[model samples]
Target: TLRPGHAQLAQTARLADLEQRLARVEQAVGATPAKLSRLGVGDHSLLATAQHLASRAALLDSAQLDAAESRLTTLLTKLDQVAEKTAAITGSSDPDRDKKINELYELAKKTEYLSQVLPQTLERMLALQELHQQGGEFAKALSEIESVQVQLMAKMRSNGETLASVEEGLKTSFATIKSNMEALDGRVKALSTKK
Candidate 1:
């Protein structure tokens, strides 16, 4: 039931959220390129990927489908590396680390799924272009494509919300685990001192 205007608003909001998250990620990843390098993740490439995604989002907003499609294709090629990085990070043997890594993996998979949806959206746009060139009735086609775009935007918003929830949950779990570890360490130290 999303209108085009509503869809645009939703897309814009999600893009803004994505940009903020990307910034946070860049800050984290940039702070420790050596750690990522040790894990075989090219830090430069990750930053580049984020920039490319931001540019593609801008292009999509401007209706530059061809350019956006090219960018998207390039982005898709980088997904594997990102996923591998996530897997490597998750492989560390830490209690809360596993949960956080799993969240990251889930987010990466969702990103891949979203990328796959882009090609289909681009295809529809291309089809609409062809219809327009034929000098025939393209109104219905446009409407249908717009509807598809709305649905895609809705799906993206839902995924974004899910990612946010996972991140929040991870933060809470980490706090709890850290508190318990601190208490246990204190108890052990006290007992050792008494002995």
Candidate 2:
């Protein structure tokens, strides 16, 4: 009887120790990403909200000014949070964290490009929405936005790949990307003459 009780107590103690270890692991996992940590200790709620807003915008069938305005408002709010957190972590507007981070940057620049192109796109979408409201071609506006988005995505992906190839370090940085492999060669020639 005594041996059985001792074994049970030992098992219970082990369980408690396991729980404590799990809690610590959870904290470390939550703290791993600095930008996310800045937002809060363990709630990615706002970033999720922004993602939801973007999803909503994508699902929206028509380009009503009100809908676009709502999406823009949500995106701007989320961007503000991300920018604050990222700037705190990186200390610069452009933070080069890693290859994946570089990909994100390229993708973001593509979105910015879309934002620039959006006024015109929005105007077209608005016009089509108006046409739809009055019983004209409403579906076409959605198609146009989809097409532009697809093209924009492809371009960003291409740029990301290209940047990744050349951005490894001085080890991989090429003179060809500088408009001439011979540019360095010319510099070398000039240096030789000076010596």
Candidate 3:
């Protein structure tokens, strides 16, 4: 009893709903911290390492999801076209009318299954993409932090070298002053002995 147009409309609505859900997931992922602090990841280095691992994993998952989505899309399009053609021929006295109806039924079932399952897969793909984005951002931030730390260490080393130089200069000046003082004391003692 279902019309072709009605089935298409229902599928379209389902797709729209799936899209909205994906958008929400994307927004949530963006809003959360990249460090995954909620998951008890507290250490900076650990978070950086975890993000690196996650980036690779997400990349692989996204690629797989892309392939699956593409295949599902192709299958869905073919099914839709076949369903339309089958529905068009239903009114004709074709010898394979019953067979065509059965085929149409089978297509509808497959289409419904794909409609139900594809959204979940797409949702996962979107979430993985968001995770990949976050990992990249975290890696960039860690890199910046490391650069700053290196600059700070270099500055500290320069300051230490300058302090050592100053200390050596002070030691030299003190030694010269002490030598001069001893020589003057020896001269005064010789003069006092003559007196």
Question: Using lDDT as the measure, which candidate wins?
Answer: 1
Model 3 alpha-carbon miss at residue 173, Å:
1.5
Q: Rank the candidates by lDDT, best first.
A: 1, 3, 2
Give the per-residue lDDT of model 3 (tens digit) for 135-176.
999999999999999999999999999999999998998898
Segments in model 3 whose C-alpha atoms lie over 4 Å from true places: 1-112, 187-195
For every model in order, what is the number of clashing pairs? Answer: 0, 0, 0
Off by over 4 Å in 1: 1-133, 137-141
lDDT of each: 0.82, 0.74, 0.81
Candidate 2: the clashing residue pairs are none
For candidate 1, write residues 140-163 as lDDT tens digits: 688889999999999999999999
lDDT of 1 at 111: 92
TM-score of predicted model 2? Answer: 0.20
Better of 1 and 2 by lDDT: 1
TM-scores, all models, native as reference: 0.29, 0.20, 0.38
Which pairs, if any, clash in model 1?
Answer: none
